[model samples]
Target: MSNNHGRVINFGAGPSALPEPVLEEAAKGLFNFQNTGIGIAEISHRSKEFTSFIANLESLIRKQLDVPPTHEILFTQGGGSNQFSAVVLNMLARWRLLHPEAPAEEAVMDYVVTGSWSKKAMEEAKRLGGGRVNAVADSRQFSQTGKAFDNIPSHDAYKFSRDPALIYYCENETVDGVEFSHEESSPAAFPFQLLGQSTEKQLLPLVADYSSSFMCRPIPRLADHAIVYAGAQKNIGPAGLTVIIARKDCLVDVDAAARLGAAPVPIMLSWKTLSDSKSLYNTPSVLSIYMTGLVLERIDSLGGLKYFEDLNRRKASKVYAAVKEGQDRGVFQKKVKDGSESWMNVVFEVFGEGAEKRFLDGAEKKGMKGLKGHRSVGGIRVSLYNAITEEQVDTLVTYMNDFVAEETKPKAEQ
Candidate 1:
């Protein structure tokens, strides 16, 4: 495939690169899906064809992730940002019902603040104005200074409420480039393994925002989560479509919540509305769903998540190797700790004045783009999403090597 989409090597964070074959197939669907003569975008959401298509899309997610039958896959508008509020409102509803006599102000929602995204989610819970949002484990507490969030807190750092409304976290914090341990046996793996240990009762009311990291690898403890939602802009397809895997119990009724002195859940924001209607509660993002469906089909053709897991591990390894080489030359410094490093987003700091600009300029000249870090934490961020092929990563790594060599050479010798 050619670099017609944008730069030769695209490492943008969200609205990131997509597989070429998926793009071509989606382009065809934009004209016509399944040779139906009508474009997928033009089809009615109420029609049997569209219903069946959405059902298949749900099945595809279930198959790939092995989502338990207790969870229901629902599609909705508004990205993961919308779910931040929805989750609080919905889960608070369940909490109120479970403890009818408890004070509304006493209801706590625990959050593990790893990076900007999880922090923002916590802020939104406070903005909702009902329950208390506690920082169960703020990684910033473990940062070198009190400002930066560059590492995952030790398991002992977390203080989840015994009977909280919900516990929230971002699986991969997109902005600060911190991610949970993908290795199951590692001590740095997911911190909530002990939360739902008892098989006698239900799983803890946990919510995860996997907006940027979803589909890149397999999810650990998939069955134990109350809700896991991802915006389609990153690894799957376009924006405007958010895929949600919600447990049936989390889709509580808003009116019932209000009667129990909890905040009213907005109709559109309610997971129950989408789940009850099979995600056709209103006119959905048809084109985005269609494109994502095409992407999932491509994934299945390529041997599902296992193929991507191995490829992503290799890609991240190469990028990290390049970064380590530059670090040894005193030209770069890795942002996150070793085990907490994100496989999907590699972030680091570049040393020397104008060195960052020079690096970006050199990358641009080589047809590599979107390596700039988030505005708040500026340095370099190379997003290795599922669509970013290993070959593209190699091109960037080679350029990185050349950039380091050029920057570190003795000036007087020249």
Candidate 2:
């Protein structure tokens, strides 16, 4: 720990910080997993060693989140971006089957745009899925909650024609350094979902692009509607892996023609093929799976989802309170509505232009790093992931307040 370089507090986004235990555990077994001669990285994925590794990750995710019996989790390659097309293709395949009479070439899709990624996802759906993607409220900056999307999805459109897969969103935008709080269910003061129409049988699947906050909190239950997918970079393990959680029905309904067609998908991106083999498609990323297993195990030891939920609340509270208190004296600034605050990433603009730069410089001098905001939105973002400790946040706050106090000193005295 003493020899650790870089920022004392790593606030960088994805490919960002990982829990120390996960790293240590992986290191311990790198050369030999469970006393096996071969290192996790060198072993053949088909071997029993790798099979156990995959099983551990699956079991951990199920145990921690208590995944339902109906759902199956598959580990695939290519990030969430790749799934953007795959989801539409798979989902639209299911969609078309449900509504055979509707125009398959020209369908209408809805997107609850919260940030850049969701917005991009919606755009991709239109280009690839070949449909009308209605973007709900869209903004340049990332947001947990803000103004309602201009055109609330019309439940009636789906009521009459093929029910457009009315998609909603929940992504912790790390770019602007803003993320979601609250559990999958409750919202003490305010709840997010407001499905205007009756989402019974006609309702399409809820495709959520949960990239950053995938494992930080409890798995959200999208009212028993759709499916969830995420890339395993930040919280899960490695960068090359992507995990998709979908209902068995979702798979059973995929176009049969494509399932048994003349085309051949090079074995890496094929979810159906991988799922059939229990994620042992081709020499899988044994090292990545082993790494993810360690992470899942570490999270389980911390008392599972509820425990981490409370723990996340405490960690986020430290930064939020500090920022709010400073803002009162006209120092720190809130970029969005205070009511719609985030628990994972805390983002705020400085009161003045130079203040932002000054604060970054001062913080760096004190061993704090990764406080810089994303390139798209220039502000400070403090990303508090599952592994981030309470003390690190406290230290960050202390520096923030002290810097504010120091800058406000009477100019005449100097």
Candidate 3:
């Protein structure tokens, strides 16, 4: 399964596979970034070369995603887990500034919990204790077993709080293979129209965690969101780089808000701090930013988000088709309901005892790996990120079809 350079087809979820060409270029940049003799890892974050590179990285993202002037892109250290706390702290501060006389108990944070990641985010908000946490929609309640992250609750099921401090949702659930449809007409799509109607003359306090599906496609209603963030490792570069797209209004002075009775936000987690210093308030993830810049450049040359969107759509279609075929043959079972399946991660169960093991072993034998599901939920998961090529997906779908055909054969065929 190894390529000429000894690289195997990697399907790992995070710290996942990157483009081969980018890796090759990055290997050179490690020794001499921008021909400055100084390697990217050892270079100073404040240096002109590094700063310019970071600025260009922001520009690339802006151009590709069509981010408007209302938002600012900032990069930092923490992964999405850290943002769980940051979002609650910062958004609550904004709420406090708007309602100086209101008690913290009076403010509510509405969370739409669809899967593992969104549930974790809601839990973090509760733990932070800045405001009351409410689940606008919990997918578990609508699931078959009465408790499972296996579906996207219909739009009608969501119960949004009027003028909540923040309305949160994860764009894609990598672990549970559940995602809201980008199509507004779909029942599984996020109920955007229902938001902001109750609060007149104010922008919606909307936030989304696009950690796993960032850069895979154009975000729907990008301008309406107050904050959208993602960790780089999933679809862009490596770990350590977290990108935040914050609406200008959301970047409030946290210390000032604290003086007004809002919870004190740590300097590092404050969006205003990161925005003011241009994402270099403190030392940044130099290596990750450098590599990500390279990836963004590659993406631009290949026609940007439109190119990857079409490619990713096709890749997911192939994989899902294989899964459907297997299900029809009684060799596989889909985990997520129709219209909620994630284009990034496809989770399903293989039929028969030892059959799952056999599938894994066979895939490994063919040089494909990282197909195992998340530990909390056991099944097979195939992650189709931007870096995974159509040829590679074809290879996987071929294996899946072969496995189904073999599984359906009579045991006496031997």
Q: Which candidate leads in lDDT?
A: 3
RMSD after Cα superposition, model 2: 4.3
Candidate 1, residues 1-414, lDDT tens digits: the string is 245765366789988888888887888887887778888889898878888888899999999999999999999999999988888889888889887899888788888899999998899988887878888889988888988889888888878777778888898988898999878776667775767542223668888999999998899989889999999999998898999999988888778878979888889998888888889989999999988998998899999999999999999999999999999999999999888999999999889999999999888888888999999999999999999998889989998898889889899753
Per residue, candidate 3 scores C-alpha lDDT tens digits across 295-358 of 9999999999999999999999999999999999999999999999999999999999899999
Q: What are the lDDT scores of the predictions, listed in order?
A: 0.88, 0.66, 0.93
Top-down TM-score ranking: 3, 1, 2
Q: Which residue pairs of candidate 3 clash?
A: none
TM-score of 1: 0.97
Candidate 1 clashing pairs, residues 3+ apart or interchain: none
For each predicted model, how many residue pairs clash, with residues at least 3 apart or on different chains?
A: 0, 2, 0
Question: Candidates' TM-scores?
Answer: 0.97, 0.86, 0.99
For model 1, the run of ten residues with the poorest summed lDDT: 194-203
Residues 1-414, model 2: lDDT tens digits: 114533366776767677776777788788787888777777778777678778878878877767787788888777888887777666666655566566654455667555667777787877765556765445432323453211222222222223555464646655544344453333321123444342445444666777787777776554354678888777778787887787776664354524432122234544566678898766666677778778788778878778777887898788887788778878887664544456777788778658888999988888778888777767788888776777777788898778777766777853
Evaluate model 3: give its TM-score: 0.99
Candidate 1: deviation at residue 198, Å? 11
